[model samples]
Target: MYDESVVPVKMESFSGVAAKSPISQCIKTVLGRARVEKRLTIGLLPAIQYLSKNTNGALFCLTAAAPPGDSATHMQEVLLQAFCAENDIYVIKVDSEQKLKKLLGFSETRMDFSCILVHYPYTDPFSDSQEFDTSVLSEAENDLIEHCETNWDYAQMPVIKLPEK
Candidate 1:
């Protein structure tokens, strides 16, 4: 997880000639400038922070641990992206390898991948805000968890036995 403070507020207008959408530019700006951290975000701490700060968004991260050359991780990313698309959410690929290691408490030898849903906090403009709707976010999170569980549970492992000399 990174510092929410550094994430620039959503742009009100984008008139650049570049082909990227405003949301893309916003995500790039945030990821490029936000401060990195050494703590794990397993409990969706970032999402909670966004809610508390009233940043008008929520963040959801999907971290997958896989063996070398496994395609499950890639498939999960695709599925998640589609899910985000259907929910009118913006998904960003988080490629901070060092930060991810700290976030997942893994050694450099492990292969992991992550994607984050940039702030999705919902608020009322006319009145004080209450709890944000996290149903879509929760569904996405549950899908990731279920995918990992299924893959890990069915994965084959080699067994070694001591020689009976």
Candidate 2:
């Protein structure tokens, strides 16, 4: 039941020693920073809930391509994409779920996640502590924002579709 009309997006692999794209590298850096800051919202349901509850935070969402034949999962991704679009949240589609898990340092655990929402550092007026240093993350975020704004239209969601077996 493969749909020939739906073209799959080009997927990038991070396993080999190949040179990574600037956008990809920025994404990795953002994810790493978010992880260290404990700002990641893992899994589909949790991400949805987080998005629903928080409307004024800087957010980035990463989703992996759904495996072939999993219509339910594919539909869920589509839904998430639509929701993100409406909320102005940036969505990054990775090559695979396994790669995402590895990037988030969850490969050693039994947990599985296809979607991760990163909460970027933001200034809080009421906080007394010094702000977290986010120079690297800021640079990466700026690059990613530039790429997305210049290369793609706002209406187009860059969700990667897994190829058929």
Candidate 3:
């Protein structure tokens, strides 16, 4: 299995904490409880995992291209969906950050979700494909946990830079 150590981390919280705090740790502990076997608490993981592996009868979210015959969305969705076909472990996707960015935004759930398979669709070099598995990401995750080094040390985690072809 991929290193889960990537997700659990301790970030520095600015308020409501003593000089020695583990805001990130609190978030990670709580999130680990919420997550399912390699799945996030939300409904999207199944979707992403299915798409990543190109599962037959692949059910997709709102892609940039094709939509249902009755649905009137965009046109470039099919060509857009094949990018992260290998990272799918769940059958549905929720575009985690967007929903959280608005719903929770500055809430505690953000750090907890640090280990989730984040989708970087509109990033540098690429624009619209998903991005997954990163090193700096793992570092950030580590910063979100409570115990600090013992729980989120670099030695415990291995980073995988997914192919960007």
Best by TM-score: 2
lDDT of 3 by residue, 1-165 (tens): 433323323334333243232332333332343232223323234444554564332211221112247232222222233342332321112223332333323344434321133232122545354444333233323333223333233432322211111
- Give me the candidate number with maximum lDDT: 2
Q: For residues 60-80, could you state the per-residue lDDT of candidate 1 as single tens digits?
A: 333333335868755655565
In model 3, which range of ten residues has the least summed lDDT? Answer: 156-165
TM-score-wise, the better of 1 and 2 is: 2
Off by over 4 Å in 1: 1-28, 32-68, 93-113, 121-165
Top-down lDDT ranking: 2, 1, 3
Q: Candidate 1, after superposition: displacement of residue 126 in Å?
A: 10
Superior by TM-score: candidate 2 or candidate 3: 2
Candidate 2's error at 71, in angstroms? 1.8
The deviation in Å at residue 6 for candidate 2 is 22
- Clash count, predicted structure 1: 6
Candidate ranking under TM-score, highest first, comes to 2, 1, 3
Give one digit per residue, the lDDT tens place, for model 2 in 1-165. Answer: 425422322333222232233455667777778788888888887887877777545467788877799899889889987888677777777667776677777776755477888876855657775543345355666655554544356565554433221
